[model samples]
Target: MNVILPTVITAGLFDSLNPCAISVALLFIALLFTLKKDRPFILKIGFFYIISVYLIYYLIGLGLLKAFSLFGATHFITKIAAIVTIIFGLLNIKEYYFPHAPIKLRMTHDARFKISEWAYKASIPATVVMGILVGIFEFPCSGSVYFAIVSLLASKVTYLTGALYLLLYNIMFVLPLVLIFVFATNRVVTEKMINWQERQGRKMHLILAGLMISLGTIMLLLYF
Candidate 1:
């Protein structure tokens, strides 16, 4: 699998540390605590939450890759997509290096909706609904990152390959978040998360953004 999805997964986890993600995580933690929801329950909700968000995002990426193939993008268009990915990737790099660049992600730990009272099957629908909602809800902010992957997948030889590219992309993208959810659920390790984000998060983000841009640039050059 192309590393792009994994790269995105890393980005998402690291992003959790940024002003946005940390804030969301903290607020989420607080929110969970407020509801008297135990760590175990919170963890389960978050697990489904991540799955919901990722599945929708991954499907969108896959669909877009296939959709664009039918367009048979003109050389100009393909190059343009490559260029956009490069630029958005740079935005990530900029945020990494100079975090004060007014980058803010207004994420909520609010679960998009809470379903603790519902049965497992009812909650299953919540994932589908939440996935679709988050996909549409966060599109504007996440469009560039999503586009970066789409552009890369579009470079593949076949639509199925492109679909697989996105599938892996989502997996990679979720890596950090899963680990985080694990730690966040652990009473022992949770304290470290918020403070770490405050001090060292930007550099982590820099590394992530830089890598994506670099890969995007290389691909752009090769396929431009």
Candidate 2:
């Protein structure tokens, strides 16, 4: 309980710092500002978008947990997840150093373009779709932490308990977005946030690299 709880919380927080999701969220806010939407409307759109991301991510976790349990491959999955997490960490480091790396963990160009189109729509349904798209597309960049956590849950807890932990983890996961939406309601703050994200993006990858490498190494040492 002690170790697992901390792991879930830390992993969720780390994953929330991912560039993919944050970038899209900031873009959505900027778009809303350009549309001259009222504060209430903007808040409504943001709420639905965040909720969509939360639900989609939660469902994805449930699916992975069920698959691991059904296959009786918790051990195998954990080993693979650890290895993949380390590889992703190294990739993040590579991204930090060589920003033009041929292989990168990020949303595809097409996904970004599609998301932008939806963001421009500035409608509730469009924002919901954009959020779902972000939740799915951002997985490539941010999923290593989630995979590791899910693998741990499958190995250490029953289905119901794992579901509960997943719920908690996902709440933490979308927390940053929630905070950003709450605070960055104005154009000035939103623009500053976008600039900050662009400036600190590489550093975020570096931080993620360190955390992922450390977590993966620990998992390997303890389980493998």
What's the lDDT for all of these models? Answer: 0.58, 0.91
What are the RMSD figures for all models against the true structure?
A: 5.2, 0.9
Check candidate 2 and list the clashing pairs. Answer: none
Error of 2 at 3 (Å): 0.7
Model 1 clashing residue pairs (backbone) = 5-169, 6-172, 8-173, 9-172, 9-173
lDDT of 1 at 65: 78
Candidate 1's C-alpha runs over 4 A off are 1-26, 74-77, 96-145
Model 2 spans with C-alpha error above 4 angstroms = none
User: lDDT tens digits, residues 70-108, model 1?
Assistant: 777634445676577567656767766665667643333
Native-referenced Cα lDDT, model 1: 0.58
> Candidate 2: global Cα-lDDT?
0.91
Backbone clashes for every candidate come to: 5, 0
TM per candidate:
0.71, 0.98
Candidate 2 residues 114-216, lDDT tens each? 8999889888899889889989999999799899899989988999999999999999999999889988898899999999999998899998998899889
Error of 1 at 46 (Å): 2.0
lDDT value, residue 139 of candidate 1: 52
